[model samples]
Target: MQSNFSYQTHDYFNFVFTDDGSVGLYNNIVGDIYHSKFGARTEAEEKFIKPLNFHKNFFKKKELNVLDICYGIGYNTKAFLNKILKLKYKGKVSIDILEYDKNLVLISPFINDSYFKTSPDISYILINLLMDEIFNNKEEVMEILYKSDNKKFIEPFYRRLIKKYEKTEYSYNPVSQNKAFLHNIYYHYISQRKKRYLKLPKIENFYVRTYFDDARASIKSLNKEYDIIFLDAFTPAKLPTLWSLDFFEELFKHSSEDCLLVTYSNSAAVRHAMIEAGYFVGKIFDNKKHPCGTIASKNKLLIENKLDEYDLGLLKTSAGVYYKDSGLKNSSQEILEEYSQRRKLLNLESSSQYIKRNKRS
Candidate 1:
């Protein structure tokens, strides 16, 4: 792996500082930020992490499996790692992440640590220590770093191996003790991905595989089942391939019986696609006045918060006809135009009428 990342800055991306003091990439072609302006890290935690109830789930099972789609900037995966460490989970985890753009992963290391910061606890303190050592300096890490144990708390590896500190290097071999340890494991994984398809270097208790190709095609070929699926792809309007009806059907095939598929989308089209694909869809509410995202699961009990009458009505209308990519062979324009023609033929009630009809009197 190379230490110099100066030449890897993507020309198609415009890095913008987000409201949460984190960096977000604005795709020139898509014309949207990779994450919401509310806060990239906060959004991942609230939408994906808390909704999953990872701590409770970790305690119930000796192993955990996750499928993170889009894997943009590695925020969702990094947040998951932080939460698991904070929970002091001692479980073996297998994560298979689908990322189409390799450049996003490459530039993630240079992203400020503020994006990784979360609420501080003893577990979080231990996480801070691991991160501090990984980056070699506390100052270079997140500003939220708290003073805590110097010994690393890498669970499932009870034995602590303390070694004399050495100058921090960005290469694959950063530490002398661990021949494979790098300053940042995720960053190392990205830097080592020199080809379109590459298997990531294994981390203790964590096995991650990155597929650098079209997600629609990749989802079909994946033989493994997922316990949790993170749908973090671009919006249907901007990138419809991943949100098509056909794509969700393929995802359903690869999902476990008890799988919880989560995404930051609450669009009627998105929800309709999930329901049409046989998933029991619900709203991933964070107790805000308005719901945040949607979570789909095989079990209805897993959905504590669900879509209201207005939403359900909207889904039945043309508003929820959804983009179609039959046989997974349609282009974005094709899917968009197909939905447009379908809506015209349905002659459905407007969204406002549905909202008015379902209004809570």
Candidate 2:
């Protein structure tokens, strides 16, 4: 696929690979949240990777399913996996992903393999090697790579492979290596290189793949029955269709009673949409003293977040629209005001001094 990245973001790290030999990170995980090339341990951990771990601890469940909306190069997916495995989630935590970009899948090996190669574990190389062997029709590839097999630690990776990897199917996949080039690349390189992990964030029990274009088109009622939904689409501005309020309402229809819908956005319109969709919405634990980001759910009295004041004020604003209107030909003050009045009529506010103070702030 061609590189559609027109601009690079300094803060967010974006990893992109074109089949035409351009492998670079555009550095925007949408807005200023993360960068691709320099995936700092702090931001990567705080915003995306670390948050998944936080959920593991915060929720304290053995098996949790996370539906990753914008499953990009899958750094977040791998990050979630690394954390879950570290936490030793024995029950099973599945992550279903929806990604439409094939560029991510195709060049993932070259770039991801390079990243994993930096780690000194021979088993890392061996498992992905064995992965290649399974995908390929090679008769003795795993045996050949495991020839010096005195290492006892790697036997688990092998056993884990049967219990999970080789047998465990992708609910959402990168792409099949059925093509000649991919197959040949696998067979040729599996043994020679140090073992690497596509394991950026991999869950043992579940991995569901979804196409980007089809994501909107394929919004089935059953799809919304997730425990947690990671709303990681590109952005509402760039990808307006994905962030529509109507979709939120549809998602709410399928939501579990205690489900938490999470995302990196703190947008007024997006928050408004969640409210319109029937979620008792608020900010998530931003790790700072103040609450940050958004989390919407069915629980009316879920923990009040840092965004309580800001969002409450917006609901009372002159520009208070439940969500950005994609149906409009143009957005103007008049349109916003119209929606604001509509919201006002719906009694969307609580009369509190905190709400007034939030407006002033």
Candidate 3:
């Protein structure tokens, strides 16, 4: 099982430090960062993993299938792994990841492990993913992760962040708390330098299969009814194809009866598409208990924060107009153009007008 992509990091492999002190990758091609600047791991834990209500759903099943779309640097999946580890879950976990760029998957293990607060078992899983998807064996993966100069990949970014923190005076806030946390982790990393050679955990029953192709094409090959679907696409405006009505319809076919499709998108267009595809949608609250994303499922009981009248009404405005890709075969530009033309033809009010009307009342 050899990969066609090379292991060498490219010139565009630039890393940016987020406000929460987690590393974020910038895609030169897309002109956007992969994770939110608020935090990479933070976004995954809060927006994706926490919203699952995992305690209610995970323990009920002996086996769980997860579909992770756009598995950028494997943050969402890694966050899930961290949570299940804390819970000491004994069930078999299978994940099918769809990522267009094989290069991103190859470099996933090189990201600083400390930022994730990964356990030894979690590190083993990251190494296993690299072994299965790119390398021939575990030794090759370990050599790159530990023995090679690749271990220094994140050092430059870490030093810059430390220096930036030294100069700034942060007030009592969440950002200050994150800065303190990173400082503690940095000190711990230095003290545990000798422990870097710890033995890897024996592989568990976790199964991961990665598809390096357009999600629209890769989704068709999936055979399992996924229990959880993490749809962390770029954005509806930048990449509408994945957020189209047809794409949601395809997801509906691949979902189990109680499957929860979670995404960091609360866009009216995206929600409208999900509702049109026959799924009941609701808001995903942040740690501060604010509506941060969307969660959709066939079972309405799974949604805790149901969309209110104002939120539902927003769908009827121009912002609620969904991107269309009939047969799931249109390009991004084509879909955006079609969506724009449709919005022009409709007599619906603008989203701004809707917001203003609600605020006055």
Query: Estimated TM-score per prediction?
Result: 0.75, 0.57, 0.81
RMSD vs true structure, all candidates = 10.5, 11.3, 10.5
Find the 10 residues in a row with the least total lDDT in model 1.
Answer: 153-162
RMSD of 2: 11.3
lDDT of 3: 0.76
User: By lDDT, is 1 or 2 better?
Assistant: 1
Clash pairs detected, candidate 3? none
lDDT winner, 1 or 3: 3
Candidate 3 C-alpha lDDT tens digits along 1-361: 2222243434445667777776777776667778898888889999999999898877768989999999978889888888887787778888898987776665565566354344545644664555434433323333334433444544344434333433452541345354354445544554476466444333466888888888898997777799999999887898787999999999999999999999999899999999999999999988788878999999999998999999999999999999998877777888889989989999799999999999999
What is the Cα-based TM-score of model 3? 0.81
For TM-score, candidate 1 versus 2, the one ahead is 1
**lDDT, candidates in the order shown:** 0.66, 0.48, 0.76
The C-alpha local distance difference test score for the whole of candidate 2 amounts to 0.48
